[model samples]
Target: MKRRIAVLLAGCMVMTALAGCGSTGGEQKETETGSIENKEVTEKSQDTGESSGAEDTISGEITMWTGTWNDGLMDTLLEGFYEKYPDVKVKFEYLPWDGMEDKYLSALQAGAGPDVLDMAIAWTIPYASMGKLQKLDEYIEKNQIDVSDYYEGAVETLYKDGSYYALPYRSETMCLFYNKDLFEAAGLDPESPPATWEELREDAVKLTSEDVYGFGLCGSNAGNTTAQFYSMMFSKGVSLLNEDMTASAFNTQDGVDAFTFWSNLYLKDNVVPKSVLENDNTTNRNLFAEGKLAMFVSGSYDIDPIMEANPDMNMGFALCPGFEGKTSAAQLGGWNLGMSDTCKNPDAAFALMSYLASPEVSVDFSSTFSSCKSAVDNEKYADEKLKVFIEAINYGVPLPGSPYMNQITDILYNEAQAVLSGSKDAETALADAEASVNKALQN
Candidate 1:
């Protein structure tokens, strides 16, 4: 199966490369002047039923800035795109994820940003609000692409005030991953994964040992701990805002209850280890793989490494458990592709975007990269472990994508962490977060 997929991807890469060669012939004509005169030609072609091939005749170079994939896969995908449209030369600049936001914002301010950009779906709203991204509604409509095929949660993250500014290349959601071997040793049912908060707490207590932790909840200063906690809040029907992105709603009873639940796991239940207070996502993952953790919240991408590292360990996954009567909730985090407002060849850029967003190409990307959804429905790509992740998306929500989201998220995490460590009570912690978030929103 892997070999067949690889062969098909290689063929697609070659075809894409050939398209790039064809586009190179017209690069001179397209670059002779600034401001994309080809837009007018493309508009005329639209009326005449001419295809993207006709638009390819007018070409100019465009740069693409990306931060997601490692060098190997990044080079392959970019090379494939370059092969498809040689006329529209792409200057690919890979950015490190750590300082990407500042770098992108600085470039935008300096008026020297890339013509094609990759960003997390959560960053879409802030960038679009700053007028740094091009609105792609017309381009999408012109191409007659159906947006419904993409995961609904992923697609919604790219919209602001009814305008589409980005298209997701990959989507991800969290799930509860457990060690089957640990479950059996603990005298618990290995196949019966926890389905509720109570069940999870009970299982954790039963699984705890001197050498192994019952659960690995990353409570360190890492950003994802806050994200994971926020998803739990959502499962209890709490939200940061009241759907309008205008006010603080996270201080409600549901929010306090959720925080208290996590706090008790550390202080009273004693199921979670003290080491979790200093661990990040990688640390937590490594602990689980090393057999020090019985269970942890993990994404689909963690499967290969964990399996490879511990060949004899029986790993399993379940949907993130729910609160009371609520359904399980997972948080969406992934990258989206968009044409820069400065793109010299919008027509060609749109064409490339359409091809990349097609179901066929998306399926191949998901298979190769272990991503959740590209253009294909996630179900098509699911194995047993992946199915748990797919199931979680049904109730998954995108992170709050407001311009003030970053600041608010920081406040939320700090206050919640204080409560978890017993430095503050739940009521005081939530009140502080509410005040902080409200002030940030006002500013």
Candidate 2:
């Protein structure tokens, strides 16, 4: 069933054009200053006697690249954009998440990238530094777009050096997803999910069985595992980077303690499985859905798959558990849309971007997929589940926006895997990871 849904989504995505900009049929204009011009042109009149004005005369095609998740959501969003601008055609190319980084880098280097691109928040800094992304401060100001409506963390993720490069379309934050069947089997309350880390530890120990683990972690999924680990650090009042983003502060005692907590779950308590060291986000998610695990940290995207896996599975989701000195913290994950530097129709592209950011269009887009805060706040989309997601965003933190965050995260995963596999202790693994990350930051 999961394979069928993936195939259907893939089929819908294949209908659109995903290639980059083709060669212009006329004399191509290249500007070193990166300034765009607005021009009006008209050929001999046809049947209609009316003349089109400059503002009504958008005539170029814009290509957009995105990762495939929900085809219904993309179609709905493009349908409205196409209706509003008949002259400007949009071509969408869907790329698999696994190879997206390499594909984006190659496209940019070849100067054949799409006009509009959807990328993870973590990639913004690296891409922006390479001049692959167009600065959007002027565009936002010219459009008079209100930034206050977006979740604070979502807005902060796209900024570098005090400039905005992209705008978020959807946001996801981690929550505790529990199986009611498991709770009943373990003589626990199904309705009340754990609200704090202490309660969660107790619940996990009680829920463990020979065939089923109490909890699961995504140690093999580097991006998500690092993100999940960071959320734990935040709950313990530790930050990945200093406020200036120049040095690594993750080696602090609080950071080490957070790592120890997850490691101890498998090492000392014997609640979660040692096999989790080899599992990624998808693997863990599948394990939970199959009723092999009691609880897991997951996002809104897991809803469809979990429901399909067990049609009668009674599952409950709550905000990430809090610690003694801190509130619950979930790391925000999402995609943003940005115009390419080589785009020919900047005006039309800006118009489309601005329209999409409006509350009405945002709500329409969110209805198909999980949307950002502005869309969730819309009365049309307001519901119990969405309200929970929105509240989760209020306590969410953005992933590290440093240009070298990818490298930093790689070190984190390597050490985390060692800790989980019992190849190294938490203190030694975290200390080594922190030093490696700090060295990478210097370069």
Candidate 3:
């Protein structure tokens, strides 16, 4: 997949006049790293009419599994899908986050899971390794789907080992969410969010008050902590793993500096609350919503929740800040739809996948939820914060799509908590983590 993307990147650079998909309202941008691979298709020109007669006729009962999407929104979107594939029936099996992996594994083992799996991008490699997903490269090429219109971060996450296992339906990247009211109270410009990490610290110190902390940190969960730290590390051009995915690359000077910067905020600067060590994403977001936190980092999805939690809160959003000379990087995440290995109707499954990924349908879907550039061309449905989130994708990078990512995150999380809890310094903790992860990679 990497080699193929390298080729595509070269092609894209030389092929300056390549056809673009979806609405051409905004300028399309490349990812932080110039790699282009197709997974979730971007915009399909409306000229490609629906399949007809015998060849286009795909009929079968295809089951789909997803997390927390509103039934009404899905039904409305699928209405168009059903119109195209009149013979294909879809049964959606909605599941909660709790025990979902176990449920999916058991069902797939018994050959009874849904034909389509709408799952987290992190799960793609693990499930693909388990031989639970169908390879989509052939399908993508045969259909001539152009994924270049999709956010580079979103599409890149589904590519692995020279194949793509899923199509990214939606995408999100982290942004700095701040309380404008708190900034005004602290005599800082409400419109001017921090442009650099040092500025962020200076403003945070000034914004910190007896009742409210300047920053809300969620350092409890291993995954959550690693994700937050990764945004900082990537901004400094520090990768968690080496090129060959053979060992940890995050114990170096840049890695240590990144970790130290975040840790010092909680320890030396005391700009974050002690409970930060116990908090998760939800906790920090809620704290910000309640106006107790002057600034926090979270995804675009948190916009509605924050607004709902505090209707009148003067909230502001901006891209994640980096060092003065460094480029910003936001951690990207979202759901993708994968075909089951045991799917009986491969053609029908592909049809459904393409339908969901189609520009028109994707636009409607993204309208009700956070989505990628390929899905929505304009900010018709987005507010100021959403616009910031969308623009940040140009600097977004997905977490290392290593099969051992879960294990590595576990190690980093534990080491990070140790640093925050004063049990270990950043150097020692990261070094220990590096040794452990390298050992795991060797195994």
Candidate 4:
């Protein structure tokens, strides 16, 4: 289970690093940037188009590369692909997560990369900037594929400037998971979890004991820490950067408050585990399952693992708590499939991608793999546990599409760690981070 958690974190942390590096067939272009928003798109109002494949025979062989899902799952998914286009052959390979960027960039630079690539959506901007990914706007328009049919955040996560390079394959959002037994033992209502930051702090104090901490916070990985921090800041209306993405905007009062909130949880209260300094989501999940922690913030991905680890442990879920009047926010993270600009068989590649993103397949795939609101609405597939995440997705916000994404993550992680360790105050830490990040953005 620890190994699995490590693998998941490894894949995500690279989203920032991999998004910053990578070369393509053409020179890199400057991308337009936008601020992250907590607003949700009106459901079912966005037009989703039909699949683009024509009835006539369109046959060509294509290769695909994905990091973790096994061949069996791919085989099952591609069963429909093969059935739809009997003449198209797919050579699918399970690419090891380690050094995937080097392998991919090397292969792509050598003019020998897979026809279709599945990667974290965070990589979409850099990959497209390098001209390694095929633009899907024309294909989408030609196919009449309604981009709105998917979660707005998942769909918009791939868009940079005015183009989309990939289609959403899977998505996950963060939520509050509490130990019901701990709540009851603390004399709090087991059925009602924290609904605001003050409530969360109060509950944590009551839940804390010599053996069990109240919260499990993550500060180890730059990407994970940045994500967790962003959710907190967003809930208070803090923006990572100003609109147009030219400079840092998180050094304000909200930023200080957000960092202070977490730092206080660890330092002032001692309710969060000290291991948070080096803990990843997996470590936190394991601790929660072991009954060492009462509550934590995480994504839909941990559901199966927690259930597998402690099937009988009573648990509850709720939206990530925010201030009384502020909106709750969660980070939208996921994978997307994009076509290589140099692919010889783009039609075939898109045919496969289109099938994977189709309505039926999207809902079916969500049953065991991903979370999308349209799919989760089906009672036959999802239950209350999954629905909590689905509702959280409605309040989801994406990380900004900046070329210096990796630098931003590092700045936030380092400064927040400093504050949590008592080496600096939240104001000074964020001020230094703002200066460092502004310098990076200038370059």
Candidate 5:
């Protein structure tokens, strides 16, 4: 499956990119800094002057752009939008994900973008900081929509500065998956997986043989490396950045310990495949399925591919192991919806957004874990294995909302790779990474 907004033009409405980012007739004002200031009235909401401030007044059309992965669900998801505001027209197109972020970046600079954009969780904060996204705090408060209803990790990614830019949409978490047969063969309990980092290492050592490594890790400079590393650091109580996010948090002794542990898994232990430097998530997944690896971490979506690759292989999964005495923490991944600052109909756009985020609709759009808590009641989610991931959501957290996320990912992975390759030790690597990341964040 396929995994993975701009400024507004003046009174002249322009539909250029993503088949036109949702923007229509509305008087526009651009300040000296180029931030759009199209004041939207509160009275134009769907709330009937009660819980939500409303009226049939919420009219006008909004254009939304998202990836084609949700192609068929578009109609089902928009059902709430159509019913809530009969007068408002909803227009959307699913674009390819490969260069979609670059397309949005270009569109924003040219002052032509969508009104409602379905953006990656990582992009929400950057866009909000750029004033490209219309802040939803006012709309959320007025409509009495509760943000607490969503997953905490997904919700964490939408905030920048003091305001949150988007509503949590789809959320997924990675968990530890193991081959039950392999576990039994290694004299380990097939039913009980690793509960802490020490246990994981012990199990990996016992499970490792000339042919099969116990655990798999990724080091390729892709997004998965950052995901895996951050998950490890978080589980061990290490944060990527300090509380204010001003400097590098990984330069500290705690970060050194975590990094050492991660690097040792490959260099010191040699339990992971030698292809780690070139490996990515897909590589590990395939290795695990091929019985070359006994354990790995990934999202629920990998279940199908593994079963398809080796139907007879017995599989078992559990929460990612925590550092000793700590709760399991996962690196949260998801998408969210945000309104463009240039959208003419704030009330209409916000109404549609709130509707889509409601508990009922969230389950429909979410591919893995719905941000809504009540979604567990859905019979499709009754599988016992999924419960492990759902529990993981409790401690999961998102990556920093830095504008330099791409650079940050590269530095994070490259430094770790340096340690793994013996080019640098853990202390030197983390210190160098700390300096580089701080410089990148400043820009």
Candidate 6:
């Protein structure tokens, strides 16, 4: 996918519009700024007659390989989806996170996969490039869907080779998760979390103790590693690739500094876990919940889990810290609703995808920020901690659209592992990674 990445939303602040699709018939209202708003999405909108004849005509069962985040959304979605397209039925298959992507590829490659895939943004292009996903531009256009209603970063995930292959669903951004109780115990102000990289490091040092580590890292998994380190690199005002995506840009001094700082937390500062080189985000989350890790970088998905792990723990959330004079960056991350190239019921599938991805439904489905900006007004996100995540989205940056994204992550993290393990200096490790990733990109 040819994504127009980077800080593309320098001017567009809060999105005033929203969107719905398929047979829904919500009205567009005008905002004070003279912007047309398509924010409402009632299942009964079909009665308003704005729906396409195809939605009114399509029928039969369509399958969706659902993920854990479904959160009972399928029932809620079906009530509306089935109501709009009464003849269409949906079958959902919940898949395990481990090896889920490979399972998806195997099924699609074998031409026996579900009609729809609840895809991650990172998976969209890879699957589309492999001819496993169905193009979505037609469905979006035919349904009068408003693409501009979503965050620019969210919209970028759908485009590949000049066509959209999926529709944005949940939007995500990483943030700082800390223990308020630990902060207070460490003599730091519990009400205020670190807002800058310098402060984060200083406070982490103070919070470190015999039984608790101050901070954590996603040590092993490449994707998890990037979720932490790449976020820091972006906040330091850097990109993994230069403007043209032809070579690695992470060898820059800021990149090295970010990597060095992360490694030092383990090797130099000694404020991270002893197994810092092996922990993934999940491992860190468990540690943090068990009162072993005082702070860590993670997205909203962990909020509930933390509370569940220790109901009495005083956890707090903060925007990811930035440099003194740079934009905070969280890897723009989220899932998208995608269709299989081998779908037997394209119309029914599109209708189902449209209903589920509609702004109204998506907000409920998003564990983090909803891809639809209108969600800011939803009371479900009224909690100050939840709002922190919504605010982070404004600073989020899209991951590179390169097909080598996995390899790029692997090379950078593996080399950084050398630095963390005391086998190499950060600068040298970064340089080697830069060269390795550049070679991967060339292929």
Best by the TM-score measure: 5
The RMSD of every model to the true structure, in order and in angstroms, is 11.0, 10.0, 10.0, 10.7, 9.1, 9.8
Q: For model 5, how does the per-residue alpha-carbon lDDT over 1-443 read when each residue is reduced to its tens digit?
A: 00012122222111111111111112232211111111222233335342322546777767777666655567666654555555667676666655677777767656678788877676776677677887788888998877777777777777665676789867777889999999999999999999887899999999999999999888874566667767778877787766655677877776788778888999988888998988888888899999999999888878877889999989998987888878788777777889887889888888877777777787777666677877777777888878877777777767666566566667877887887788999899888988898886565
TM-score of each: 0.82, 0.82, 0.84, 0.84, 0.86, 0.81
* CA lDDT for candidate 1: 0.67
Task: Give the candidate order by descending lDDT.
Answer: 6, 5, 3, 4, 2, 1
* lDDT tens digits, residue span 93-150, model 2: 7665556667776787677888887766666655666677888999899777887777
Per-residue CA lDDT of candidate 3, range 186-277, in tens?
A: 99999999978889999999999898999877788665677677888989999887766667899889999999998999999989987978
Candidate with maximal lDDT = 6
Q: Write the per-residue lDDT of candidate 6 for residues 1-443, one digit (tens) a residue.
A: 23533222111111011100000012222211111111243334445756645556887777788654453455655665655665566677766454566677678768878888887676666667667789888778888888887788787778865788888877777888999999999999999999987788899899998998999876776667766777788889788887656788888888888888877878878888899778888888999999999999887767777889899989998888887787687788777889998899998888878777777888766655678887788888888778888888877777765556666776776887788778999899988888897786665
Q: Which regions of candidate 5 are displaced past 4 Å?
A: 1-55
TM-score-better candidate, 3 vs 5: 5
Provide the lowest-lDDT 10-residue window in model 3.
Answer: 10-19
Whole-model Cα lDDT of every candidate shown, in order: 0.67, 0.68, 0.71, 0.71, 0.72, 0.73
Worst lDDT run of 10 residues, candidate 2, spans 1-10
Writing each residue's lDDT as its tens digit, candidate 4 over 328-404 gives 88766666788987899888888888888776675544323343455665655456787787777767776765556
The 10-residue segment of model 6 with minimum total lDDT is: 15-24
In candidate 5, where is summed lDDT lowest over 10 consecutive residues? 14-23
lDDT of 3 at 284: 86
**CA error at residue 427 for candidate 5, angstroms:** 1.4
